[model samples]
Target: MKSIYILTLLSFFVIVINLSSCDQSIDNLYTEKSRIQFKYFKEDTVTQGQATVYRRTYFDRTTLSFGMSDDEVQEDTAKIVVEFLGDVSNKDRTYRVRINPDSTTAKEGVHYKPFSSTQTFRAGRRKDTLSIVVLRKDLGTSFINPVDYRLTLDMEATEDFNLGMKDGLYTHLYMNNYLVKPKWWDGVGSLMFYHPKKWKILISFNEKWANKEKEPFNFNNGGREYFEALRNYLEREPTFDDETGARIYIDRLVEQNN
Candidate 1:
């Protein structure tokens, strides 16, 4: 019985050793590689935007509040993480990053704060993150001109690490603070709701109203009450019956979301 117990303990030790070795091998697989690039599926959080539209290569547009009070507006930060292709290194590695704006329309300091020109990936680590803070006050436009600002991030490899992919070496972000006319919007001002209900109302509207443009409508800034009322109204009347005269009584029935 003692011999059997000893044999079982030995087998467990062997299994643990094998598992540890496997984990080390897997870590080395990436650490030993000469490549480093952007990590995929990482999300960016925006406090003032409704949606982030990603295009073929990079981000297409980051929607911003059209008109909201100071309390409603929050600063947005984009955390971009880059990963090393190989196993953890003994020595710390540092890479250079360039944050270049496409035009002078959104000047630094006036429109947004400037980001550091370099980011370091500490030694023995597979990934490093760079944070780009977007100031809420900078995302505004004057009545004379309205335009979106484009910010691009370019990553360069050091002697220790090679640039992983050509396509992912650079990424772009657009900031648009102006009120956007939803493609689905009729000439008349209409309400847009959050998901699920928005989809249901849109489908119903398409079948009945036959409006060709079906893009999700934009909520008026500071229209949280308006948004809730529109959502509730859609829940009750997906068909948007003219007889109910929702347009006439919407403002009285709604309260602010905040």
Candidate 2:
């Protein structure tokens, strides 16, 4: 009995040792080399005029426009989020993003203000958002000949963040100042909902509506992100309907959407 008890204890000790070693291996994996990764947004908070695009080389992308807005909006901006991983330092760390010229065509200071040096990640912080300023003044007078300028940014490897993602490290910006209806607005929204003045104001609330994809909105439900804003705009602007000349009755849709 004494011999059997001793053998059992020895087996239990070996099992615990193996478990400890396995746990250590997992801990090592949990400790990643510190790095920052860029993402357009974490979730559906993108009601701010951006859409996700799926392609062969998957990367974060968003668009900026001074389109449809009044001349008062000569400038617009886009935001990119950065997330920190690994050890949190007691001191602030600095990082920068540089335009990847191979993928960029937008001229700095003309289309966008140049980025200043060294955006900081305060000590013990895990996330930050960077803004890119876009200018609409130089976008020329041809509403018919719409133009899109591209700006792609890359993360700079720094001492605090040597690790980087193999993919999804790029944020591509598609910017334009075309006041014309985007290629998508023909036939559908144009039949009843189409008036150049109305369309211009509508596009300001959500620019993606002008994008070339068919987006169905359910006023009865909560699909429209800028519903209140649109409703208010329509109420204030009394554009008469050509047929009956009644002010475009949005109250019917408002009743349903409400």
Candidate 3:
């Protein structure tokens, strides 16, 4: 009977321990950690029964190059989207953003136009876009070669919304007017552009000067001057062509562009 009593007390203690552990597990399961962050993708709807997975498409700091070869008529701009990371609230949330020149290479009026310092996420809305336009005319002669001009956007904490992860706090934009080698430049070469021949010639000529010139040459810094010099060099046709011919076949076209 004493053994039975002892067993009963031990059973009760074990039951209490299990119940306490279960309670702690439940508390941890229900713990809500709400956060707000920037959403990289523009997907408006999540598929039915699909888990909500966040993919970071935007970078904390990224460089975006605008080639001088881009269509003159098309508007040039970049869009950044910010969103909530946790459960949505009943009321609309307004988030404030601050844009500042992160690097001296780019200026507000010269490389890009200023953006509004604030963005809003409606009560039911998941994300909002911040657009920054790149002025092509302003880009031509403003930046120094090889140096990247950067624009930074900082997420500000406000009563309506709180900042979330590290990525949500800041984003960067680096703009330049050089002929940017596309992401697939290695596989596809100059075929990515509409005018492949012109692109090839320009790329070929630039590569030549980059390899042989005493001073480093780049299409972004003094591209206007470099191309002008190339044209003149072709025209003069120094006897050195027979002695030290241009390495690239495109030099013939460069001399003929006149």
lDDT of each: 0.56, 0.66, 0.56
Best-to-worst lDDT order: 2, 3, 1
- For residue 38, give model 1's deviation from the true position in Å: 2.5
Best by lDDT: 2
- Per residue, candidate 2 scores C-alpha lDDT tens digits across 47-75 of 33486644333447777766556779888
* TM-score, ranked from best to worst: 2, 3, 1
Model 3, 1-258: lDDT tens digits are 999999999999999999999999977742454455665343343444667654434446555555544456334777776776666666776777776544345777777776666666777666666678876665542222344677777777777766787756777777765554433323332222222233434455676432222324333554556555544543554422221232223234222221
- Candidate with better TM-score, 2 vs 3: 2
How big is the positional error of residue 222 in model 1, measured in Å on the Cα after superposition? 24
Which 10 consecutive residues of model 3 have the lowest summed lDDT? 239-248
Q: Which lDDT tens digits does candidate 1 get at residues 1-258?
A: 999999999999999999999999977765544687766444545454777664433542333333222335656665666775666878877777766545334566655578767667787787877666666666754322556766666778777777876755766555655444445544334353322224334344443322335533333543344445555765565332222323222223232233
The number of the candidate with the highest TM-score is: 2
Cα shift from native, residue 31, model 2 (Å): 4.3
Q: Can you list the residue pairs that collide in candidate 2? A: none
What is the lDDT for 135 in model 1? 63
